[model samples]
Target: MMSGFCRTPFKYQIMKKITLILVTLFVFGCKPTEKAVETKLNYQSQVAVKGDWQVTDVSYANSDYIKVSLFDLGNTKCFVNSTWHFISNNNKGSMKINDYSCAYESDITWYINQNNEMVIKFLNGTKSKKVTTGYVVQYVPINENKFQLIEQADVLNKTQDIVLTFERI
Candidate 1:
């Protein structure tokens, strides 16, 4: 009787181990491993956008009715003529607003994600990991020398894109 009790527990231990192994294998095996598809345009856009750029224009659909403050910095007009330096090697850059009243500069880290959106974060002298707030904008490349960062804003109770056109410098 004693031997039978010990044998039963041994059998249960083996069964538990088997069940655990199977569950782990099933869980891991079912996990999706497909990588995100990287399009040619993504690579080309990154290449096209890299280097020094100047914001030549900033326009919105209905600017006359709605006034927008961009990046919590200043008016959209302040961004015009701003200089942006995009270093592709580490995807780090700086933005300098040269508009007389809004003269400011900040360190930024940016990247073109798999979705073709340009994600940017203003470090503002802080570490990138410490900064949680960031911005994502539609990245449109007209040519190697020209690109647009389109950001959506609430204008007159509707969503509108504030387009910032950039030309390579």
Candidate 2:
């Protein structure tokens, strides 16, 4: 017996519909998403208040000039604890290892422990520690390329102090 013609319209139609649906989905799904990117701010951009200040000279009572240096503790993810060191100006000061207990905010206010009576707060959110007494040190710029350490706190009995100042570098 001879076979009859077996052309089926449904098969081709189904294939066409499936191909169209797949193409439509692929075209829409492969599109790149419209993303809004946030611009990362530079360290300098946030410290606008310190922009007018520069390091000119450092002085430490009962301490050597060469022993002071600025310490960057950013590796610990504590931005607020970044400090200014007052070491012997001739020798490089030792790198500080700070144990970070909490996150730091960009706005950091530094004060000296004059009379050894000031309470130093810890990042752990506990009560501040009482120091013996030291001059609260501040970095001030007398002018461009000239700076001075303003001592507002009393230095009671501490023999040495570390002050770290940070600029763009």
Which candidate achieves the best TM-score against the true structure?
A: 1
Per residue, candidate 1 scores C-alpha lDDT tens digits across 1-169 of 8999989999999999999999999999999996443433355567667899999999987676667988788899989899999887678899999988989999999888667788889999999999988887888878778889999888777888999999988
TM-score of predicted structure 1: 0.73
The models' CA-based lDDT, in order, is 0.86, 0.35
- Model 1, CA-based lDDT: 0.86
TM-scores, all candidates, are 0.73, 0.22
Q: Model 1, residue 69: displacement in angstroms?
A: 1.1
Best by lDDT: 1
Query: Per-residue lDDT for 75-138 in model 2, tens only?
Result: 2123223343322221111122333553332222233222222111222222223322222334
Write down the worst ten-residue block by lDDT for model 1: 35-44
Model 1 bad stretches (over 4 Å): 1-41
